[model samples]
Target: MSDDGRQPDDPLSRFLHGETGALVFVREVLTSVLAVALVGLLLFAVSGVWPPMVAVESGSMEPHMERGDLVFITEPDRFTPEFAHGDTGIVTYETGAAEAYTTFGEPGSVIVYHPPGSGGSPIIHRARFHVQEGENWVDRANPDYLPATSCEGVPACPAPYDGFITKGDANAEYDQVSGIAPVVKSEWVHGVARVRVPYLGYVRLVFSEAVLVQIDGGADGVVPAVGGERVSVTGSERTTTTGVVGSASPTLATGSAHGTPTATA
Candidate 1:
């Protein structure tokens, strides 16, 4: 019997008194988990999204964003800019350029969006421009970013029912042109990247990679997504921005720079 009139081996008493090594360890773990949960809840309250942070798995964004960077993201409607597009609150590169607005050092917002029918993680790229359904967007595209001369040759041309064209900063081609993703519908957008913390995301990346290797019987590699599965975006000079497509789980978005430039997140 314990001095306090409780059985010495009583789990509640032992845990309360820190008398059992295993119980103490369990308490510590629970405490740590609770703390993490609180922090996540706070972030969600502010960001209006679950898992408000993401790790950059590739260098598609390059000088602006990099692999191992931890990026903070908020729902698109959380902080709508004055120059934002319609109710989406996203400013495309075309509009940002004209308005002198910028994110990650260039015009426009860096957005995390799930491409239609991808069934993978979301893609993190800059919104280059908006197009209406059936509209020929080729004329508005930068010739340097397009592989084809006309709308007929481009893969996602004619707007695909209203969406944004995206690209990684370091890539030579737009995501649509390189087959990284199709049009990014406004509803498909998950969040907008606001800030980046360098090198902190490596922890998540390493942990996630290990789990994936065990589950899928594949080597640890980072494509994009919140889980261990990755969609490979391999290329050096030619990057392609794709989702689970290394984007991460459909529920969470991971980031990378893909272009034939080879960026995937």
Candidate 2:
């Protein structure tokens, strides 16, 4: 027996000998397993590949999608000139891939490709205009007889033109003169703006727009100028906007932007 009347070889003592170390080991393992499961679940839920996206920088999509809203995307397979009017899907400019929009770069011009009887693109006004359907024309550099303004993989240009229009929702005026190219190929479309999580986008806007760094350590620090994922919009509309094709996920509609709610297909 030990000094305290407990045997050194007691089963209870042995169990308690390295309890802290054991706890740490168990904690680390559990954490790793959880992380793996989470990643796998996300991958499975969002289809095979993970998408790249960020929060809305402005309120161009206001009354529908607000500033600081979180947007998820999925690329389209083919670029068609027509979209149903009054429809709010993710559209891109002729400039570059989807990632380019959020990055620092000069805005390029692109045409607003309107299919016959279809309404124009949605409200994001920051988009640049590339080419107009009949206003601009292009001839391929090779004997392929393709038009410069026509999208790829479609029939010869000007005959069966399959180009796309692009624009920014917040802009006051439409682009008409830049002569930017159209997104004729489906590969050019990085993804569709599938869903918008309100208020969640604000965090991304603050970080990407440098709103926090400007106010850090300042007298206004306590004023709650907006930082991190906690700031909420005053009098903001709380209702969710459902997609046109089908109903949006209930969790996305009701949950807060900062909440780690999963989206169901």
- Judging by TM-score against the true structure, name the best candidate: 1
Per-residue alpha-carbon lDDT of model 1 for 1-265, expressed as tens digits?
Answer: 6589767776576786784568888988887767755765676688786456566655567788766666777889887778899999899999999999989999999887655555433557899999899999999999999878899998888777888988878766887787667788889776777877676555445534411332123222433222221211211111132222123311122322221111244
Off by over 4 Å in 2: 1-33, 36-49, 77-162, 175-185, 206-265
> Cα RMSD for candidate 1?
8.1
Model 2 lDDT, residue 54, Cα: 28
State candidate 1's TM-score: 0.75
Model 1: lDDT of residue 38: 72
The C-alpha TM-scores of every prediction are 0.75, 0.38
Best by lDDT: 1
Off by over 4 Å in 1: 1-14, 17-20, 210-263
State the number of backbone clashes in model 1. Answer: 32
How many clashing pairs in candidate 2? 27
User: Each prediction's Cα lDDT score?
Assistant: 0.61, 0.30
